[model samples]
Target: MAGIDNIMAAIPGGSTRRFYGTAHWDGARWWAKLGDGPNNLLDAWWQDPVQPLQGGKIAVDITKDEYGQAASFVIGGYTDQPRPSSGTVQEIIPAGVATQIVIMGEDAVAYTTDRFIGEYSPGDPVYLTWDAAKPTVIGKIGASAPPPTPDAPVLVPTNPPGSETLIATASDTYWAPGGWGSYSTSRNGGEDIYTGTWYGNTVTGAWFYGAQRPALQGKTISRIRFRLPARIRGAGNYNDIAIVHFYAHTSGARPGGDVARVTGPHDIPVPPGFAGGDVDLPLSFAPALVAGGGISIAGNPYTGFNSRLKDANSGRLIIDWSS
Candidate 1:
């Protein structure tokens, strides 16, 4: 038989009891053997709304069962749900933030132990949320930021009236792939590509490059390449990075029928530190925009090397930037 370690904190007047454990209170039927006795008076059975109360608090109802060992309320929010008040903050759970109650005084003749304190205003209401990852407390209450006033107008982008066309400019400077750019290069090493903005005089066009494999379904242009430098680490390391050429059709659209071939302008160098030393490379072929629904970008397989690494403080990165 399993050992028993439960000690009940009965209400002054009512028979409702609360049990404590190393982790939490299990139901009396299941929490019979807690091992450790009630260590503090704050440990008691209570049922409070899971939502965070702004200025008010609610009462907790505690009572004893027929056989009366000790029992506590359990719900999704009690262990799973997040506190409603976690607005813009990542909404992390606070340590030692248990849902148990502290018994201040019990009303002996009332037949109901005053489970909790704090008054609830008529205005405040409870909210609901979910946590499939784990069990949580229910009815976590939180406050939403008040609407901003006109003087404190919330900033939002506004489209100009009747403006249909957009224009963008191409910079000369080389930019790292997937990195932001506005820089100009000296000899056009196939490094910088950007979305052209539409001006009254000029209609800026988008840049596209790389192998246009129409037969390969789901094959997409990785990005609008202003430039794609070769793998210039030394001799034989360069593979002639692709460049942007001219568009087949005039209007910028998807699944573009026109394709551009390799246009000259090759260089070989390093972009600082690879296996050591500078790495410089040049663009091989010109790039062109793709249109229609047939193109798609491919994803890379993730390595768990980052998973095994821990933060300096020894914390694990469960949810990554991409995750």
Candidate 2:
């Protein structure tokens, strides 16, 4: 009992457009009849007959128009029995059953059922039967499609953390008389000699440098020490009292205007040259180290005595700080 599936007819150029019908094989030939509708009542018979042998089958593909009306049909080949409904195994469960599948007639919709009869992987073509209440997977059809290719990985860069540090050092000896803007009569000793003059109440002169000078730029003077060789003019008199004062200036030169008095106006008693030792003065309140422009040092001799700062291996200003 072989037969063609359901068929529908289309009327060209007519409002009574389409109608459903059926076709069957009557042992020796194919026969068809349209439904009893207006302009659709007709019987059709295959012009070329098909005579099936004792145990044989046939396959066919029918073409349809845009209106889903039969336009033409082709007999593909012959087989043993009617072809069973088949699908591709979309997903398989642990129980060796296909839970999701795509069928010939319902390819767009994934049909869910416990139908698979054997262990199967996804994408394996399958033969199935849905005649019973639940669908059943009767057998495998063919090999599955290949798995999709994967993409490559990407690379990125990472940076390390940052930190802070403090740099400190002792600077070289910076001289005075050379950086000083104004001065009185002074002599230069190649190594060791007494140069500046002495007067009553005014022993030595003032020496200063201008503001924003390059040597002191972006630096603070943390400690300042001066090496001075001193001696009294008369051999017998040791009462040559002199006060050495260090000052940081803002504007004008020496003894006037905005002045930051640093180091000391401390007294130093000048002994006879044979007994005179080094004068070590540690300066304080050196605000000019950060704020003002330059610094200076002057001498104040007490009333009746005359003192002088000898120049030889002395009068070197040493500064230490962190920039």
Candidate 3:
């Protein structure tokens, strides 16, 4: 169902308007406080806290005039009131069968593509009726509708499972092993970074990304593992290692700790070199698997001297650290 806005009371005029704490049908006229204190009129639906009538419901001798129409009611109802967007709504329906859907907008109970009868506009008073198959042009709202396209799969950390810690100078690469290609982190591509302050058991200065910020900042990461993809050689592409490089510092700003340098090739080293041999580079990340500054790919070191690594085949540098 989309939503439930306001419910307008359908009351009749001329009747003595009286606030009723709790009105019960007494054969003839529904009796209650005829005005004199706080319990003078029916409470607002949104204000009321009670279960509504159900199938084959009925309301008799209800005031049908203009003035004494609206009565007490609540805002959301149907399933446990405050409905969940990913929840399901099941009604006996004139046909019968539970149809699940994701509600989108307000007045959701009034909309149902199938077996749609009529809709209850916002602010409509609750009217009791005992006709499960009432043939009326109205139907209760279903669950919220789903989006048109498939949603991107959420990125759930498999390795470290929490914050990752790396020495300011170390070039350690944390890769999620076991061929997990389906998952992707919200922390993809380049993002802004923030540093933390360490105190006691906690060492401050943990860098963070803006878009996909870590669950907590400055969290002492026990350990981290990068989930890497198993690269397959294309037609002409050889089974060579793709070298990854690491930089001690991205910009001129270096965070306190001394830079831990990686003295190795940026790209994954090929056994027989890049001479197109049967021997494979075997994409291994053994070198920079410890607390260090940052890991990068490429043989040629840029401005600030730091750690560098590369893929043996593609040579495309992959960042395998939690900054």
Candidate No. with top lDDT: 2
Worst 10 residues of 1 by lDDT: 300-309
Stronger candidate by lDDT (1 vs 2): 2
Q: Write down the RMSD of all candidates, one decimal each.
A: 24.9, 46.6, 26.9
Error of 3 at 7 (Å): 50
Q: Candidate 2 — which pairs collide?
A: 57-79, 115-137, 191-312, 192-312, 193-311
The TM-score of predicted model 2 comes to: 0.27
For model 3, the local distance difference test gives 0.26
Give each model a TM-score: 0.16, 0.27, 0.18
Q: Cα lDDT of model 1 overall?
A: 0.24
Reference-based lDDT, each prediction:
0.24, 0.38, 0.26
Write one digit per residue (lDDT tens) for candidate 2, span 171-230. Answer: 111124342222222323121221123342123232233343344444555565544444
Q: In model 1, where do residues sit more than 4 Å from their true spots? A: 1-128, 136-144, 158-290, 293-323
Against the correct fold, how does model 1 do in TM-score?
0.16
